[model samples]
Target: MASSTTRPDVETAAPSARVAGRLLDSSAKLSYDPLTEVDWETPLDTDFHGASPEWSTLYGTSYWDELTEAQRKELTRHEAASVASTGIWFEMILQQLILRDVYAKDPGDDAVQWALTEIADECRHSIMFARGAKKLGAPAYRPRRVAVELGRAFKTLAFGEAAYAAILVAEEVLDVMQRDWMRDERVVPFVRTINNIHVVEESRHMKFARDETRKNLAKAGPVRRHIHAFVIAVAAYVIVTSMVNKGVYANAGLDPERALAAARSNEHHKAMMRSSCSGLMDFLASARLLTKPALAFYKRAHLI
Candidate 1:
């Protein structure tokens, strides 16, 4: 997170304690261990997709129409693996941002304890996603270099609502996409289990993020709030763009340049993002973070 002076949300106690207590108790009762819980022993099923087909970046492109069923399945599998890899990257950033947010605070406090718990969950989740991608037969996928560098800086410097709201946006985007894959029968069983675990565990994280964003904004002055809002939007844009690595198309055996072009012009995929993130947009609007400059970034990212 940024300098300690910028983090007013951590200085509070009553509301933070209530939220953190519930989260900690809930996690104890319902959290999963992906190592034992996921059905990883089964052979990879070529008949199934790694995620819902509609979530694929090239789902409605002309190239999609040209692909055979096997080709389409292969593409979605690579796409899913790419998404999982991106999840791992973002989770790493989130863990660091959060750990920084709680640094030197009261370790015994429920809020700090819950932050630690959330970090543990993300650690397990990154492992699960890595295993899932390997099982799907995709090579390691990483975000673009620019995104990688920006994430390093953001995790190191972002504080208050900027960090929390960016966290919320990433969680909400993954939550919606994973919800579909978890429930879709066409998705591989092991991958479905991974998505299910993430969706469930991240629910508490999202709740905490939303609460923290509001609390931070409550203390922020007009100038600071406006600045963080734009920063949050830029972070969201980078995250959204980085979700699918460019290597996926080529790894899936498609023409890399052509597939990339098609995916870029994919109105259907953009519409899906906009539709899925409606509630997230509502939350940002309610928080008054959707300023004109911020909304421009959101629109350019097709997350409006």
Candidate 2:
């Protein structure tokens, strides 16, 4: 009775988009709230410990001075980049604080307690980066209007935890990237001090991300939920990556294209990317967060 087609005629169904909508809805809860957890009352006496004079020698003070005014301008731009990067980190912490509030609503039995500790570390990092920028003679960075708009937009979403998770992925991946960059660069004492402080603290935060995300995924059973988490994670990564491509580099007066080129080709930068981002991908993959679809998505996004 079967012609060559013995197999039943099958209709391929379109993937359900409910998960995608839920992920976006979850992401809409992030209103950029002012961080209130930091103890501003504590003195920052150590913040002013200036970088050593020997540091100037590394960049060759005389040669550095001789660079065209444009090159000098580039340093200003780089400092601004530092601030923007740290600002993203700060926003992530703010998201975490909100997430903590949400997670508290239905706390996981094995939720990581270290989130509180990482919050303290992030606050210190925000201060350190801001101070570092000021020391380098860059103006203090105020949050951009877009940050406010996005925050307000997200705040309209009712599903807060999903929104927070989206932010978690965004912040954690960037921190992982920064930690790698700091390790590779051999700067003078002052900049080195800043990097040293951030790297040490960020390492723990990265580990915490691994553990916490693992727990979150473990609790997710439905294929739709997993897809939802993946979409949010992808969105978070996009937001962070876009920050670098947008005004962060250009505002500092550096040629964004050239600087990106330098960052990509620089041996130290490459090393850091490998150590930090590469390791993060591996960890997530090992933990089964990076399934075939996820890996394919990252590859398409140029993240892998």
Candidate 3:
């Protein structure tokens, strides 16, 4: 009986093992040390934008057209810094989640090893984002108080598919914007390098997250699935909304009230978000995590 079960166990573990092993190999081949890779010694250049203008929250708003070129660049720089600050916050949350998820698991498993490697990558990323934000001459941009408390709660309680799926949503949203910023000549060189490093490494993390989400959900009953789906959707809404802080408008020398109103109604920015997240939305739908309740949250976040 034991012998008969051996093959089934091996078959079941093979896919996860293979994925983790490949990710480990990939990390070894192309991982970066941002400490040395980013040109930290160079003086910050005011001429370069911190991000692509089109990704700006106010990009298509009437207020955006009134800004001078320097003002526009300044605005984007602060916005980029705000985004990076939010990234640091979420990365901290995710590191704890991953650590918690792997606690008491077999240390020798490839999946466990891969999770640790991913944690190491995220630690470095948080540091890199902090430095980058400072270099952009932006102040610390923390999430709103409600979001902070919610993230604290989520990081403590989320597990399995709920945890992994939330991680995927954050990575996917940042991935799309960073992909554009990394290639745009208008973005500062060091910032571009940072984006490139993050994009390269986070790709593997996203793959692992997607795999983990599917695997975990496979074991969940219908009730659990629907419950986690709503949880993950709420998490996504918080993350997406927290990306650009409200203070960025004032920091960029814009009228905060006017900028906020314009940004709230910016159809172009909403469209960009929906377009960028289409693939992620499809993945959630395929996993059957896009319940009617979940879809409503995603729609409100402009991620659908």
Candidate 4:
């Protein structure tokens, strides 16, 4: 009788398995599609075409425009590399968040939705970079993925909440940077297009990161014992400093070490860096994680 009963239970399992398969399929549906969602065909306004002679006066458009065709092409080539790197960074950020959410075992549906949106954005950005390279007749090179070393570093060094906050601040800074470059008369149209797409999406991303970070910090125990938050904050500082160094200036054929030195020497970059770093620190202090010791450490590191 027991053996006979087992066959009926097995028969019952088949229908349940079918139902589970359908649920999995439904859940796999993508929340966003980059091709349909982005305004790829949007026309560039005339300013990007270097049409106005006076435009050369307000900005150093003459210096940019006076480059020989070959030089202009080389700049485009380098810009594409820069864009490729930016896209890779965005993809890494998305993957890191996904891994964190999984590890925390508190992955909400909302978080998954956000991840999917970011993935779509990253994919679109990758395509845009590739397209720019193609248009410029430059060899398309994929941005190297986050290395094993980086993963190991995160495992050992990361603080969840602080890292998230840093990401928020860095995104805010980059959003401003992209907006400025996109509106520059000397910037090429394709470059402006890439920047415009990023600016549109990242504005929302930055706001979400900031708002959600505050909400998360408020719910955290007032005691500053959270290891995750600490790691995140440190990661943010490392990344932001790296952005000006390896990320931006390096791609422009400028020496990053020298650029850092130059930024220290120049009032503008130094002032911008200081103000931005201050904003990041203020947020951490508000969350009670940026102790006097931490602030002093940042100052010593020249991160402030």
Every model's Cα RMSD, please? 5.6, 15.5, 5.2, 11.5
Which of 1 and 2 is ahead in TM-score?
1
Per-residue lDDT tens digits for candidate 3, residues 113-134, read 9999999999999999999999
In model 1, which runs have C-alpha deviations exceeding 4 angstroms?
Answer: 1-13
lDDT of 3: 0.95
For model 2, give the 10-residue run with minimal summed lDDT: 49-58
Candidate 1 vs candidate 3: the TM-score winner is: 3
In the range 183-204, model 1's lDDT, one tens digit per residue, is: 9999989999999999999999
Tell me the TM-score of model 4.
0.59
C-alpha local distance difference test of each model: 0.93, 0.45, 0.95, 0.49
Cα lDDT tens digits for candidate 4, 52-144:
112111123334444554444444445445444544554466556645644644344444455455555566766765665454433444333
TM-score of each: 0.95, 0.55, 0.96, 0.59
Clashing pairs in 1: none
Highest lDDT against the true fold, candidate: 3
Model 4: lDDT equals 0.49
Instruction: Indicate the TM-score of model 1.
Output: 0.95
Prediction-by-prediction clash tally: 0, 3, 0, 11
